[model samples]
Target: MKFIGEFIMLFGIWLLLTWSLAPAQVIAGVVVTLLVTGLAGDIFVFKASRAFNPVRIFWMIVYIPYFLWYVVLANLDVAYRVIHPDLPIRPGIVKIQTSLNTDMAKTFLANSITLTPGTLTVDIKENELYIHWIYVHGKDVKEWSEAIAGRFEPILRRIFE
Candidate 1:
């Protein structure tokens, strides 16, 4: 059951990425998905979960709009900094901690930070994530984590953890 769920998710992602309805493309996707599911399906799907809850999927769907909005804002911010006469940027690596327990939640957080325009995830050790910020906001770890991860963390916790 779990394998089936994971395969569906994986194959669905492959389909989205390829956007091909051809028979060969779908057959290849199914073959690849089967191979992955046989090798490491446990790592992909939530442990002990055969299927995702509809409510959680709904929350994730809701989050997409917010995430996209931030991406747009971040692009504008990066553009402004690049075009500014003084080039006001203070880039540095900062460490922060998260209370998110699940591996999926942490991965999502790291990816979200990396997707944002001015931030890139450098490393993650246990619950701590090191991020390279284009503008170092402050040195306070808790405050810094809140500034960077706060937006998505709470929603992720509700969705995945």
Candidate 2:
């Protein structure tokens, strides 16, 4: 089941990237996607049922816009900082613990943080994620975690866990 799900996903990506219905392209896509899926399907997808869940699917769809909004906000913030050197940049690495359990959820969180312009994911140790921020606003670990991961956590929990 995992293999099938992974194959479908990889093939879908291949189609989206190639954007062609030529027989040769599709055959090549199938061959390549099958090979990749066979090699990494287990690591890529832990559970086929969870991957196909309707509620999770809906949240995943919703997460795209929410994530994009943050990306836009971060870009603006970074642009402002670049334009004005007078603004203080309290750059530092801060550790925040996540309540999310699954490795996939943790990975999504890390990627989301890294995608934001003002922050980058440095390391993830178990439940704790170390993030390098352009400006650390939160006073403590709890505040930092809430400030960084708070918005995404509940939605990711619904989607990935």
Candidate 3:
């Protein structure tokens, strides 16, 4: 069941990317997706039922736009800093703890942080993620955690946990 789910998801992605209904293209996508699913299906999704849950799917769809908005905002902020006369940046690494229990949830949080223009995820230890920020606005760990990972955590929790 897990293998089938992963294969379907990956093949859907391949179809979307290629945007073709040709028999050859579909056959190749099936072959590639099958090989990938055979090799990594176990690591991809632990629970097939949860992976296909309606609420989680809804949250995942919602998360795309929410994440994109942050990406745009971060890009603008980074651009402004780069083009500014003084280049005002307070670069520092701060640790932010996550309440997300599952590894998938944590991975999503880390990737989201890294994808943002001004913030990069340096390391993740247990429940805490160390992030390097272009400008460290938050004073303490709590503030930093709330400022950096807070926005994405709830949405990810709903989708992955």
Candidate 4:
């Protein structure tokens, strides 16, 4: 019952984002959305947390542009390294300690690492994240540790903490 409502709300959001107002297309999309909802049910159980606060969602909308800018900056940095003769990549793994205390927060941290180019989240253990970076910008692990944790963690803390 709760899952049905969540599915419809999420489907409506998808419609608004895509701007699909055509009658036939909207019906088709709803059908596909239902299919996806059914399949994903077993995986996540799709329950809105009892502690869900609308303020978090509002902040996410406010933060979209900032995330997009970071995405673009990371893209250009990767492109620059790929084109330069020097191939300025210093590949290595480093551990980043996170103050995040929930599955949601850890998931967001891992995603942010992967979304930013030049880094991959290799694994997460307790409150630390293991990341593989293509380039160690300053060879300062502490700086890298603080970069993502500081840049994105506050907003996510507001969202999920």
Count clashing residue pairs per candidate.
0, 0, 0, 0
Range of the 10 consecutive residues with the lowest summed lDDT in candidate 1: 42-51
Q: After superposition, how far is residue 161 of candidate 4 from its true place, in Å?
A: 2.0
User: Could you tell me every candidate's TM-score relative to the true structure?
Assistant: 0.84, 0.91, 0.89, 0.75
Candidate 1 lDDT: 0.88
Tens-place lDDT per residue, model 2, 81-151, is: 98896975889999998999998899999999988868899999999999999998868999999889998
Q: Which regions in candidate 3 have their CA more than 4 angstroms from the true location?
A: none
For candidate 4, give the lDDT. 0.78
User: Which residue runs of candidate 4 sit more than 4 Å off their true CA positions?
Assistant: 13-35, 45-52, 137-143
Worst 10 residues of 4 by lDDT: 44-53
Please report how far candidate 1 places residue 135 from its true position, in Å.
Answer: 0.8
Clashing pairs in 2: none
Q: Whose lDDT is higher: candidate 2's or candidate 4's?
A: 2
List per-candidate RMSD values in Å.
2.5, 1.7, 1.8, 3.4
TM-score-wise, the better of 2 and 4 is 2
The residue-by-residue lDDT of candidate 1 on 32-142, one tens digit each, is: 999999999766646435136777788898889989999999999999999999999999999999999988889989999988869999999999999999999876999
Show pairs that collide, candidate 3. Answer: none
